[model samples]
Target: MPKMLCRCGKVVGLGEIPSSNQWMIISDTMITDEDWDDNGLNMSDFYKKMDIVVKCPECKRLYIYSKGFGNEPEVYNLEE
Candidate 1:
């Protein structure tokens, strides 16, 4: 599990955080042209930009964790 610091100086584990309403699981194959046109992005581009976001319960801050964006799976606090 990864640990993240909140904006209020509270350290919390990524896994322990409540993600019921703070996560999005996007699939490349499920993206249609309408969705692409709505977001002004292509499916291929979206596929490479998939990521997971978790929110800090303490300060209501967002923490984005990259999954397949050609980067390491690291936690990023929005406040930072």
Candidate 2:
């Protein structure tokens, strides 16, 4: 498992089953009729097209994995 360190000194990590802080982002343009069918969703293909996002519970910082988890995430902080 990979862990990310937030600027607020909070550590975030993913699990086998995503917790409350883990999410996947898929672009609206990336979705098509072909991606869905009677056989249900193509999980493997969907996973490949999606980007990972993790939120730090303590500081509420967002770590975006647009370039994959192997690289550093693009951090986003709450403005308010």
Clashing pairs in 2: none
Q: Local error of candidate 1 at 44, Å?
A: 17
**lDDT per residue, candidate 2, 1-80, as tens digits?**
45666788877666547577788999999888777653688688788999888889988888888998788888898898
In order, the Cα lDDT scores of the candidates are 0.58, 0.81
lDDT of 1: 0.58
Query: What's the TM-score of each model vs. the native?
Result: 0.40, 0.80
Per-residue accuracy of model 1 over 1-80 as CA lDDT, tens digit each: 45655667877664544545256556667667777577656656664556666566676666565653244444544444
Candidate 2 regions exceeding 4 Å error are none
